[model samples]
Target: MSTCKNCQNQLTPDSDYCNKCGARVIRNRLTFGNLFTHFSEEFLNYDNKLLQTFIALFAKPEAVIRSYISGTRKKYVNVISYFAIAITIAGIQLFILQRFFPEAMSMDSISTEATKEFNLKILEFIQDYQSIAMMLNVPIYALVSKLVFIGEKKFKYNYTEHLVIYMYLLAQLSAIGTVIIVTAAAFDLSLGTTSLILSPIQFIYIGYALKRIFNLDWTNFIMRTLIFICALIAFTVIASIVTGVLMYFNGDFQKMIEAQKAANEAARTVKDTIN
Candidate 1:
């Protein structure tokens, strides 16, 4: 027999709650069975439901959200869980693709002296401020959504709702990006005309998806689309500038390599003539 500390009620050894006051009772012994029971209670008890929700998320995102928001949440994946799984999958895909496809990992592949320098500098910057890239998507989406929805009454969504949209958008983009990366890796293809042309179209899809998800009207939807396009342009400009700065340094390196090659060729020519 045990007693509750708060209510002073008599409790059985196996009892978790006080009969009198309903306060929780703590067990003194921490055995393997008790640990397993606690673990089971927290995470493992809902394994089947979690798996079911995950499947629904990939199959029908809108339906999953609709179900969850309408109080049918038990049968679907929670928004946080969906976001976590999507982000984890995206991260893993990026890692694998980058490892296997060096060209795909690069922003540009012209391989000019300037481009080489820029690439090295960008790599160094990524290594130094890795966390910045991880946090960029949320803030970028938030800004775009806020700007697009400004002064609009019917199209307005709260921050949390916007966050859900952002997650969905991220998941879609990550899936597309993964497919592109994997294909490039398998075929050893360059980021040529196909990528350049399709990339803008992908943003169009994102804008359309956002409009549908938020139930925005055509005017508001167009504004959101423009915001996305602007954001893309801004990102491109920043990347180009960074690459240019790095290329300046790379030019010196390229000169040394060129000079070494020329010297070796001249030496070989002299030896051949003497022989």
Candidate 2:
């Protein structure tokens, strides 16, 4: 008999892993080659759970989601792990943009100096705390989904289940967006332009996934997608209002106006010099 190092379970002499804890029976001492091999098997292998989950979600989101919801968890990566990976990737994307392509994220086209500063600050804040922002959006997305799909009886899903759906959808979208952005950056593409192009694509994919999950027909899918868009717009407006109020309290609003006037005068002086 052999004792498992991880859980002290007794195993047959030739067992490759512990039957109780599933830890590999590492008879050999730890070495760099074995460590690299372990890393490859965990992450880079085509049979790895993460890679399998990523492909399956794109190919058949409905099946993966439904299976997970129905208590079939082992086949795919869980929702929390998937979302965590998305956040990590998103953070890396932001870091790359800030570090390598600072000009791409710069708001140079805006006319007012104060407004530009304010906008840049907002952008910086989002980039700095993007993980929190992404996590916060997940629940809001779940709420929006619940509102849109409240009438379904056959696929009656509660609030938490809706969270699972959006977590998967949003994580998948984030992964896709990161790949697209990174590729675009390699070609010296404008980050803002790339992001704008991705907005509609993200919406379409979200709708497609939902359609698959609910088995919705063309008419229902279109109607629901429109409603989802409207809900998002409404949420955006409300959030803007709240943010504006906070800025006003902090005296940023008044400063912005004064700065805009100064910027305008400066622009006029430059134009006069050229003329």
Please write out the lDDT profile of model 1 over residues 1-275, one tens digit for every residue: 77899988888878888889988787658899888987777457756655555455455556655555556777755666655665666566656656776565554554454355445555556545534554466556766666666666754566666666666556556556657756776776654423564577667666666666567779867766777678757866886777556655779456646666776799899999999
lDDT of 1 at 270: 100
Q: Which residue pairs does candidate 2 place in steric collision?
A: none
Off by over 4 Å in 2: 107-115
Model 2, position 182, has a per-residue lDDT of 79
Assess candidate 2 and give its TM-score to the true structure. 0.92
C-alpha TM-scores of all predictions = 0.55, 0.92
lDDT of 2 at 134: 86
Query: Residue 41, candidate 1: how far off, in angstroms?
Result: 20
Full-model lDDT, candidate 2: 0.87
